[model samples]
Target: MKTLKGIKTHPLVQRLQWVFNPVKYMETNVQEDRDIFKTTVTGKGGLIFVNSPEGIQELLTHDTKEFSAPGSVNGILRPLLGDQSVILLDGDRHKRQRKLLMPPFHGERMRNYGELIQKITRSAAAKWKPGQAFIARNTMQEITLAVILQAVFGIYEGSRYDELKQLITSLLAVTDSPVSSSLLFFTALQKDWGAWSPWGRFLRIRQKVDKLLFAEIEERRQNWDENRTDILSLMMAARDEDGQPMTDEELRDELLTLLFAGHETTATAMAWALYWVYREPKVYEKLIQELETLPENADPMTIFRLPYLTAVCNEALRIYPVGMLTFPRVVKEPTEFMGYQLEAGGVLVGCIYLLHHREDLYPEPKQFKPERFLERKFSPYEFCPFGAGVRQCIGMALAQFEMKLALAQILRDYDLTLLEKTPVKPARRGVTLSPVGGIKMMMNGKRTPSKSVAVPATV
Candidate 1:
């Protein structure tokens, strides 16, 4: 097994552009070890995977200034999300766009959603009974969609909420199965025609969502409601540093991105947390004991302070990261990563999946242990499931808070277990990772997060 360190750019490395599904290919036998040192994926083919903590730091923290988002992502997502989307921008433009979008995801701002989180989760959990199987992802998605809708629109029910939910749900239906697709970010595919022709379905769904959003924008504009507390209101009221208001198109793009990014990833994280803790009784017991210490009526701050719960969330993210890769970065100038002399315009990806599972950084990386996060500090590069740098996920804190609270609330009540005894591996679904068949789990009953810690899942 040759390490990528001394290896020259092999012929396979040069042909990486021809590779359509790089992530699925990541595990296949290409890199001699498959643990590290996969081929560089740029036109110049000098990409290197130094899964070391040090390498993670150099690339994500130190070298980030040089790397621009690969043109690949800009090509795919921009069409769906629009050129003004936060995902599409780079450099200063990215910074400004992020700033405008940051308020909704801020810690203080997110704190207000805690009640809604518990309420929504509880509401969804009410319908289930023991012996009846439920898809964990669907439960999480329904709750997440409702919670995000309330937070984004201030309309918890009524025709508006229903209409918006239906439209958004319909749009998401295409990719909601969460199956891994190899074609997520292939830049050249923009020129390639689909064999079956997907544009018609894509356009039809796009029109449905757009019509709903544009209609909402128009309604809000007509009435000009200042009392609305949802994200839409914030966007309506928001003006840039120069006091220039965002256009309706800008509003649609940002709102749509938030709805898409904010909801699904959090739901997936919640589902994985449930699975890992249930599968490992010891871990579940520890989490219960720690959670039990909190007051029955503990506020959002107390839940946020629970160290073990935070660790659990961190570990779940580590084991099966919802997002396997970071926003791509292109080589700005000739550089050497891990002594592989790479030329300018080379492609580099922040291979988050590989880094999280690195044995040196995480001893027994495959094990489900939350204590690793507590024992030592991992460089931002090593532990960045949400990514690092100024371009980090805006909803990182919000997602963590939501996951911790949501899981604590659920675990405190319902006794749940995985429907199967075997483990399910992760694959990229749309832009996030989802379990195959959406994780079948049986809920024993509900327990409020404040009372008994780890209640026994009903036998």
Candidate 2:
């Protein structure tokens, strides 16, 4: 067995780069070792970052056997999402939690939220007047946040709902930038000095959010309505093989997990879609042309099925996957990977950002070309924006649904312009990458409904 190679940079410097400028960090390191490399940025023992599709496939496909998706490896997120989140569970426990939570985000149950998604988007758009400048990410966040809240709680309006919305937003904002995101990376920085300190401020807001979550959980427990379809209610009623319900602590953690994962990532993807669409006139015109063919008052599923719209969303997610890295998968036993020997307890992660940008897989990888998707179908291992295998994002179906429907409604009804001439770059936002400056834009005017027409072959 040969020793695995890694970045030559000092551990401290690599860790700093990982926290402060992860894109640069990964790009520079991958240039040194394209397929696989080790780095201590994640922790003391170091983690193996795998960029090859085969390696990622092997790592994810045998996750339950050759590799174990241990919750302890995801300790970096425990502070924000709590310990009991499906994101933080392993083995049978993880499978059971996913079983209970999966229903609300998939199948017909997910489709039920389509009308509500469009309604939220339209309501959000109504607030913007012609010539109004807005941060696309912030605007989209409001829309996605509302949709997730309603789906989770089954209520869109109320004092607790409004307060939870505000508190959760505030809680996440504390880590909106790389500097602030550092608190999550370095345990030493997590000290709560006071309300004025970054970590302190995060703790205070999180406390408030927790109080509200527990209150909602406790209130629902008292009522225990079997008819309620909201995620929280469903979770409360869910019984394990042992016939036990999720505890309040478990409920609180999972709720935070759903909000953070379901809301922020989808909003960033939508914002980027808007950026790419408006930035390229051909793409925008072509998308509108495709959307125009839909009959008046088209249902959400029809809008979702539009090929160009699906490609556009696919390209956006591919260009800058909201989650840069999948949760870490630890080796269950000594195994060979990509020509190198690996030992048990070794940590490995699928570098989603790097994989998506591979020039071999995507020609002119940096260029946003929805046609790539339209021209050919890529294997799941090659084109995964959501991580693959057992730990794949549970909200994958709903996020895609929300993206297509929201983009269709917004583009169909409103004419918006990108404000910046220069291309925007992705920056670290907590654990994920988001558009720098949130992709500023301005509303031009609303477009009148166009009659159904023949679809064009090209833009």
Candidate 3:
């Protein structure tokens, strides 16, 4: 059997490239080897990066049997999401934690957040004037963070809520650059030089967040509210197979996971969707035509089912996926992948970036084309921005719902424009790729619905 193709560069160099300039690194490597490549940049040991849809499907579909999705492979995230976090657990523990957390993000519980999401968007959008310029990502971050706080802890408009929001935003901003992202990838650089130091600042902010989280957990434990449908309340009330409730640390870890993962990535996505919609005049006009088709009094779910809007969101995700790779899946037994021999513990990651950009899967992959999604359907594996299988993001449904509603609300009610004609480039924002300079834009004015559509009651 032939060995996997890879960059024959030094491991340290590859690691730095992977952490510092991951987009460039991935693009360069993909040009050299189209389908798969063996690399040593992700965490430790050897890792094979799979790009083809068939290969990605093969890996994700049989992940539980021939391969295993272990949380230990996600150690790079441990400093941010603690060991007990669901994202870092494996096997039965992972399954159980997911079950405990699943109820709040799916079904009726998730639907309740729709109105709140639209209200939060409108509330945030109200502050802007016709001439005022704003960073789309930062604004979106505020909306998403507020939405998560309300959905997760059922807290809004309080000192604790305000403080947590400020601290979390500050904490995430600390690692918004490529150089700063290295702090997470290289654990050795995580030093406590002082409170002002990069690592030191992260730790200080984290300590404050932890104190608040622990206090929240303790208070919730002492006074459990069965009536509340927020995620934290649901998690607090859940019992495992042993009929045991989660500990304070477990609750805190999971809360941080939900807070960080839920808001941060979605904010980036919303910003990108807005940027793309405004950037392309044809797209902007088409979206407006579709939005005007719905009555102004339409429910959030009705707005969500819009075809062209869904395609726009999907196209944005396809262009720059939030997560570059699936959580690394390990070989559970000896198996061959595309003629390459595998050991029981070999590591592999489906390169979501490469897969989404493949010309075969998406014609003219570099172009921003929403029509492709509307014209033809793509399989789950072919268009998985949230990953798939056992490791599929539990928040997928909520995130998509929030995106569609928030975008619909903003697009239908507000007129915004990119501040500059230059293109916005995607750069590393912590673990996810975000628009550089937060995709600066100016709010032109509020959009009035067509005369045919009755004005809806304001939330």
Alpha-carbon lDDT, every model = 0.71, 0.87, 0.85
lDDT, candidate 1, at 344: 70
Q: Write the per-residue lDDT of candidate 3 for residues 1-459, one digit (tens) a residue.
A: 866655789889998888777888899988877888888886446788999988889999886688888899888888888889999998899989988888787777767888889999999888888877888988898898988888887787788899998899888876678888888888889999999898899999999999988888887778877898788888898898889888888898998898778888999999999988887777887888899888877888888789999999999999999888987889988888888878788899999999999988898998899999999999978899999888888889889998999999998888677775578888887888888898878777877766443321111
Whole-model lDDT, model 1 = 0.71
Which lDDT tens digits does candidate 2 get at residues 1-459? 688966677889889899888899999889877888899886567889999898899888987678889898888888899989999898888999988877777777876788999999999988888877888999899998998789776656899989988888889886789988888888998898999988888889999999988888778778777887777787787888888888899888988898889899999999999999888778887898898888879989989899999999999999999998887999889888888888888899999999999989999999989999999999878888989888999989989999999999998887677887788999999889999999888887877756542221211
Residues 370-437 of candidate 1: C-alpha lDDT, one tens digit per residue: 99878987768889889876567887877887788888888776778677656777655676677767
Error of 2 at 362 (Å): 0.9
- Residue 4 alpha-carbon offset, candidate 1, angstroms: 7.7
What TM-score does candidate 3 reach?
A: 0.95
Candidate 2 segments whose C-alpha is farther than 4 A from its true place: 450-459
lDDT score for candidate 3 against the true structure: 0.85
| Candidate 1, number of clashes | 7
In candidate 3, how many Å is residue 183 off?
0.5
What order do candidates take by lDDT, descending? 2, 3, 1
